[model samples]
Target chain A: MSNTLTPVLSGRADSPRLAWVLKRPELGVGGLAVVAMVVIGSINPAFWDAANLFSLLRANVITGILALGVMIVMLSGGIDVSFPAFAIAAMYLTIKGMIALGYDGVVLPFAVATMIGLLLGLINGLFVYGLRMIPLIVTLGTGTAVRGLLLGAVGSSQINIDRMPPALIGFGRLEFLRSVGGGNGLSTMVVLYAALAVMVHLMLRHTLIGRSIFALGGSEEAARRAGFNVRTTIFFIYGMAGALAGCTGLLHGSMIWVANPRDMVGIELDVIAAVVLGGTSIFGGRGSVMGTMLGVFTLVLLTNSLIIMHIDTTWQRIVTGSIVILAAAATSWRDRRIAA
Target chain B: MTATPARRMLALRPRRVDPALVQMAALAVVVFILMASLNPQRFLRPYVFDSITYMAPELGLLSIAMMLTMLSGGIDLSVIGLANLAGILAGLFFHATAGASGPDLRHAGAAVLCGGIGIAVTAGIVGGAINGLLITRARVTPILATIGSGQIFTGIALVLTGGPAIVGFPGAWSAIGNGRVLGVAAPLVIFIVIAGTIGGLLTRTPFGLSLKLIGTNTRAATFSGLRTGRTVLLSYILSGTLAATAGILLSARTNAAKSDYGISYLLQAVLIAVLGGTNPAGGRGSVWGVTLALFALMLLSSGLQLMRFSNFLVDFIWGAFLLLSIALNALRQRRR
Candidate 1:
């Protein structure tokens, strides 16, 4: 039974004094992450090497950013399988538009991309709020449509940015504490990931809108009865997700230095998986930003360690798929166990 | 409006004329007229119709498979994955036994056909069974379970085929893909027969009744003494098997099997099933509706191609149509 969604560590609170641990949703994931690092680090000290770790972080940070967005949507009881497509479209447009305008700057391209993403997310919000349609189907359709339209706009011809504004790539490349971890401390992308995580965490933990999101996810009818403006919250949540995705697309593109319209079409699954693996319930009402980050690291570490050992990336999907199943199974087991 | 005996009898008849079907049917007719007027030269040709007949069935089969799952109140996102995996297995079996350059190819042709089918069908049933067990025993929601299994199946397919499409089937393999039966494509014949059998199973069997009841309300069905778990299990397995049928036809038609073939169909098949009027919440659908929806979509798709619109535009239109239909349906339901 795949519904074993709540963290086993948190569930242990029923036995006593472990309630403190339950309050820290990210603890178990973080501990497991440390164990994973030590194991992988011992297996191959190269994994602890700065370059490999940085590369792993770089490989994961896209999903890391997107997972924060996914966590928001999931926490609100709606799903957006279309965010990758949405992000990809916004990224493609921004890159192409910037290249055409010969514009190159960190803020300008990112702002433009984020605004585009916001608009698209607003459309998703409108469908959920106005039409009263199922969020999953609505987003799936719109997401597909966006990708198709983007593909139509950009053919097989790959858009290369030879004159990429140094400021844009520099933002992604900027590293802090370069002397640490054998001269690989951290990149600006990691900084951005942390910044976003902190911002979202504060908003979720302290803000009224954040409380409403949790309430809405817990039960729409109950939220409505509690005087939460469910429609407005849904709009804001999906819109925020969209804007984040847009930023993700640009961040990913600039990091890679190419605007391949076809890439990341189905990458939302990875984002969703990472968030869920972090102990987020797929049916909503519970998840955390920090846990999601840990989840992202855990997945990336597994993948990076395997690739370090010369195992093919194809097996990564197998493990991820199995983890999703196991997580879901755990949730189901928990539900039944609690019921009993 | 006074009801006589005859009028009362008519009112009691099943299927009180659904407006959504009527609306869709009208849209189909209008689109046909528009296509004919814009591209009469190509649209009017028999060969154009032949191509539609050929291409529509594979997509149709996948849609119907989704429709079956939807009928039971769950969806099989893994259907396409299962279908492709089945095809890949059949392909691997054929490749191993009667490859083009094999010395025993002369005697192994029949083996290729038989073995190809035997392996493919078994793969479908097994995949479907796994889906069933995951949903019923594992207690995973259908979407998450299928998504996970879909990934696994796709990974296995990729690992087995090593990314490249496996080709080089026996010469007779062409008959199922390219050969004509009477006036229809062999693929069409296969599609129709399978659709009809599945349709009959859904309509004529007690299993169908139980599934519908289960979908409408699982607790109610259980209280009323139906094996809800078994019903869920059977429906998913059938959906998987149907996906396999599509996979086999795909291999036969393309003369190849790859991990990613018809990957796009995952979205489109869902589109078709929903467009065919299967309730997303489950319990109410008809194969006839799916068949009709298949015609509408295929017509739109073929028309767009006939006009030389890029394939991406076709994708756009399908997505737009799905959104529009759902919106309209919601509005209509609210009005009622």
Candidate 2:
């Protein structure tokens, strides 16, 4: 058995054909997601229903946005463990500021919220890139500070969006394909998610900044030697992530009708899980927006199915966590095989 | 008086006492001054020592676990989860055997002693094993793996209790958690013992040396045939065990267990570890430094509570301190 395996292993190592088959790791995750969907749908009839499917996509948007930010940071060879807290903080401050300023109108709130998010992200980037500190520790600190700021800003009362302007409420309530016979099939938020995904895909694959991010992730020193403004790029990446997280927070506020400091506490776990499950390497330098989208979808679908099945929320968390571990393990196995 | 080659080598080796320790000491001084200014009478009260002694044990255990993992160049974010789980498990074990209504005086003493130490140690070791398996054999990054496992562990705890607090443990168990020995809390004593033992292991044993080498340079460790994978695995296991033990102590003290029991400890553990001068990038840290950091943090927190500061203010201050520490560490490393 050893002799036979040795010949096969050596032959494969020498062959480009075998290498091509071995190199792609994301395919395994994609395949597992498909299998999981089929098996789950088969076991639970409601899993394939349109209403459940739409909610899965809708629920996934927030995670999708956060994961997108995480992907960029990871692509730049950094990790942001503070996004959940930052997202909640950004959301709280944006809504509070708007309310205090009496800019209850739609355009102003959106603009201000985005700007606030951008500013917050810039701080993260500055501390991480400019100060040359570890991204994890810096963001963790900033994340706590931001959460505290939100608590102080909002006090004990949660800002209820129900009293907001009708137009803002409509934006929150906006759904796509509702008039068509699909039973409120899609949402504007879902459309935004898709658009963002497309834009990110292009930026990562086509643009010079995207290439630079990939180069940085691949090797920071090499990229620096290659004339890439590594610090500037890092700042941009982290800032972009923060801005996106802020936008997601706004979306969350609109969707949930409240911006509480405690809401979404420790949610970075979910975002990171989605990124990892989508087959992105934690070591950074390689990822796909499409894969992340799928990852988000898988988690959302799983959660929805558990709810539909009336499984307890606690069990749901366990299942979701197990899935993340399984996904990570699968990715690692694939990487090892490729390396071997 | 020419410097010998040995002396030069010793000088070149990373300082036995990290410069971060100096910053921490400075931070401690600043904190003391701030506390004094805020409320001199309360700050000087002997009762504050009691508070520190009470909080030290669990914090110490948590800091040691965190320090061990950080030294091996990984972070275990799942300690809180593991601790919560262990606490719940201990509660259930006590409740089942001793009755859930009140203190089972007949069995309470043994249960408290055996259950507290036994369940804690087992949970700690097992949790560490899982982390080790995932990180080593499965080749998952420590942060992601631990975070995922943490969720799973917390979920299990939640499931066990149906998302409610598990209470009605024997009084004797509580006594051990709340009891003092030699003018200090038992928990503080436990912390000292564990920290001292682990510290000795980390600094004295071949295993400890290997861990430091692995954390500093994995490829170099591997090339030296140090079994880098096993070393990482062991560190993670040790971390898991320590976290679990902390959880048990927490449950015993509170006389109840909840899924959220260890949640608040997560950030605190990391903060204490780093504040104690453990490099975030892994390798080069000490139990002694972390122990001092634990006391400093406990003092600061207790001081804030006495001052009627809002939880938000406390959080903000802590976050500021964490950021400042990291920034200072970065600067010092750059200078080196």
Candidate 3:
């Protein structure tokens, strides 16, 4: 009865083409995203317009970057909820530092922000490795503490668009594929996202450290036995994640031309949902860059195009939550099949 | 080496002290002293105690709910979302039934009050069932499932309320939040009764034993023929129910229901539950421990507030306290 009820779970790939598609790993999410785009586009022709497509891409760029960082951590069998806080702190402090020094250069500011993020990530890595507590709890505590301290002892005020560094704003304005009819061209952020995604994909596929991350996530003790220096890998993943988050935060602020301390609140769930939807296992030791990028695209389209499709904006959360559940269920079913 | 003073002292004491009790007592004394030294007149007043009694119950209930799931090797991140949704639904019930003047349940009669409670509790049960099914049947990871469910709950609340708070609960309902029983605050009384009842259930019931066994070792529990799935489901249902109770208290106290009410309470609940000695990895926790931890945090927060500390600083302290307590617990486990 249950087998009949769950056809997707019970059915095996009957054809060579179907089996090949399934084995590629990335095709599943990529195909789902294409289908979603077509459906949404058909429902609302406006969704296919260059402006709307650009807006969708804009919304995804920051979250996509953050999700990449989270994907790396998840790949290493750890959960991090602290990146948002670190990102904001790094962005805000970098701006404040620039203002205080009366300096307005893009390169130095981004470098400083990345360094700050790396430092915060190292702290999380320290606690997770040293205290040997669960990553979720450790990150939760650190995230809260970092946010609170930033608001309390540091500054709670927002850096408005006018007060933003001109150089950084100019950097954000650099774009390509300038559309006709006065439409805003795609920002340089898309290029950055693509480059970063490709870089992460290559690193994960080619590097020894990347393999160590997978091994650590698969089984910590086993990784240790294999002489992978599990501690270094743990530190490396978190630090890398933090650095990316920090850079993305500043990128977000520059694009929007403001740094609000409260921005990025409650984004952990959305990014995590997207990553897992992309086929990254919450239990770790599985996932891919292509899958995660496609997953983010699907999520961004669904959320951004709700208005165009005549759905209530509030329904976005419901749909996203359902996606998370369905994705996790699919992952669980697949894991069981492999085990069997 | 055998005749050392420390060894002799250890030999002299047959029973070890409960760390939860010690932590609770030490926290109380420290907070009391600190507050007294800072502002003796203001801190020692009945008004301050009254305020703390009123504020702690909702958070206290949520912490207990969090503890229950943790004890079963799971967690309920949906507590806050479930809580707000429950409150909003109950408020909507009263809003729809009450004549154009708005719901003033004080004179609306006993049946109306019962209806509100019933609505909230049923929502809790339904929400908990969803979480349970996702975890046990769908086999989604507990955290991921709860996170998703929490989002759904909050979204529903947002859709229902249209981003604004639902006001006008029955006056009688507010009385439950604000009224006193023999000079004690009503919320405190309710908290005590529920806490005591849960404490009894955990110690005296088969379900409780099975939950702990499952947490401690799932394979062993299955070998022993324990109903692991049912126990996990009950844990979530009970967690949801407790969260609903907190929701009722929140609406009654504030006289309104919103989608984002008590959002910060989620973190605090997790922190308090863990500080109360509920292991994050599961298999061990006590109602008494959680109760003590609740009081300790309440007093500590109250003391900090009395000192005119900013809310941000308070949040920082709570996070620090959680980290410190976890570190201490880890060290203690290492020693064992």
Candidate 4:
């Protein structure tokens, strides 16, 4: 785990296979995903259909982006349940603002949503740092307040497709590699998620701020002693999370063509599970963008395949929860063995 | 000059009175006064009091359950889900024995009531044990573990109900929810007994002492030869039992059970637990503090309802209250 946290300039000069397997824990999740995909595809011919594949990829868009954000926060040893609230608030509010301003441009709406999210995330950073309270409690407080305020004071009504901005909806509907009759094509969201994943990966691996976040997660005291501005870094991490959530929320609403105040309820646990499943340590200071994305992919595949296999959709929650418990237990058992 | 007065007050401060409980007591009084003044006729009526007592027990039990977990340096986010699952299972029990059809409760005997309630209690025990095993034996983080189990519990409930409220409990069964014991709500009486028993368990037992020690410092407790794992596991089981009792009460009150009933109670329970001075980081809380906080919030919300405030506004206030209390606790600790 410690080796994974630090940058590895050179590979271990031991028997390459075992060393490589041990070094990249995320490969396990990827392998599991592949196996599950193959088993499901074999069981159900529809699983390999382009339409099914595109829809599954589409389903992963918002959640995958959220998982990437959460991966960053978890790397800093904080758990945030408030991102979903902030995401919906940003999305609903942004759409409402666009409607009021009679503005329909895609880029501006996204920028405004991102800014709103950044502001909300900064507030979380402030509370967590200023109050010196647990992240879970603080975020719970803010999340509830924001959700309450959004639904109560702002407006609880759904902004349906009838009222949505035309350009924004158009952007959401954009796709590449379309069939002649437009029966199957990849959603623009897939591209958006991929691009964001790459950007996050580069930022986390190649930037000083990203290193500081890892250091902070490893040990706040150590990071402080090592000349890191822990406060700014904390603020940056939360701000980034919020910004991503905000951006993703608007994208989600645009893709669905509806901005419901109650959208994205109960997504916190799922996103957290995905990030954890991806080989990110729940304790923080050990995660990667690729791992988090793979985690999301695996989770999306597992749940989506349940439907393809003619299983009850309600079983999805039970399956996801079981996976979370099993994964966490496995991680703990492995860590204990190492300690011994 | 201000520092001198503050220092003098601190010197005179007695170690016996808990400031958090006292604060809650004062807040309760203030809220009572404000509500009374705002609508003397409506707020001071027996009907309002009866309704408050009626509604407070389930949430009150939940807060107590949450407080117990917090006292041991952990939390159980699954209580609400566990409660719903318990209720659904018990509801299924009534459907099985008494029959689910309308006005056909001929088999609604004392035996049936007991059986239904027993089933709910058993569900709680099993659910709590799973959570306990996960946190203790499997070494999963309490929050993550509970979150996962909560989903599983809710999912099971959903599968059983298939997306609709299960109605038709025996008249006697629902009487527990709506019936009065000597002019007091039955649920209120049940709440008092359970809260009192749990309070006594926490204050006057070796188990309580062990819990406090563990929460304050688990390593020290472990070194001192305390059974930390066993104690935590027991606490979770107890928490689950309490939540299940609340579930039965809820089902009885509504005369129906559903997978997603009382969804908002989860956060409200957390709010009440924290407001009651249960430290989220673990250790240092009380059943009495929780009861007082519950009364205060109930009074505040009831009053606000009289003033035509929406439920969402009440939620916002609850969240604000949680944050404010956390900040106050931080300030108090810093001062010490």
Q: Which candidate number maximizes lDDT?
A: 4
Name model 3 segments beyond 4 Å from true. Answer: A1-25, A179-182, B1-16, B100-106
Worst 10 residues of 3 chain B by lDDT: B5-14
Query: Which model scores highest in TM-score?
Result: 3
Model 1 segments more than 4 A misplaced: A1-14, A17-28, A154-156, A181-185, A335-340, B1-13, B100-107
What lDDT score goes with residue A24 in model 2?
Answer: 44
lDDT of 3 by residue, B1-336 (tens): 334333433343326666766876677678778877888877888888899899999999999999999987888999999999999999988877774244344467788889989999999999999999899999998888999999999999999988999877788889988989999999999999999998888877887767776777677667667888999999999999999999999999999999999878988999989988887777777888898888878888887888899999898898888888878888887888
Relative to the true structure, candidate 1 reaches a TM of: 0.93
Clash pairs, candidate 4, are none
Overall local distance difference test of candidate 4: 0.87
Q: Write the per-residue lDDT of candidate 3 for residues A1-340, one digit (tens) a residue.
A: 1221243444565644434444444666776777788999899887777867777887889999999999999998888999999999999899988888899989989999999999999988988887898888888898998999999888888988888889988988877778541467787799899999999998898999989988888999999999999889999999999999999989988888898887899999899989988888877888899989988998887788888889889888898888888888877766665544
True contacts kept of each: 0.63, 0.68, 0.65, 0.70
TM-score of 4: 0.94
Q: List the residue pairs that clash in candidate 2.
A: B124-B241, B128-B237
* TM-scores for all predictions: 0.93, 0.93, 0.95, 0.94
Candidate 3 TM-score versus the reference: 0.95
For B1-336, candidate 2 gives per-residue lDDT tens digits of 244434433443555556666666766777788888989988888888776787678878888898899987888888988998888888787767767775373357764568656876797788889989998888888877888899998898999999999876666677668887887788878877888889888877878878877777676667667888888888988888888878867877887888987565777788899889887677678887887788778878988989987888778778888887777777776788
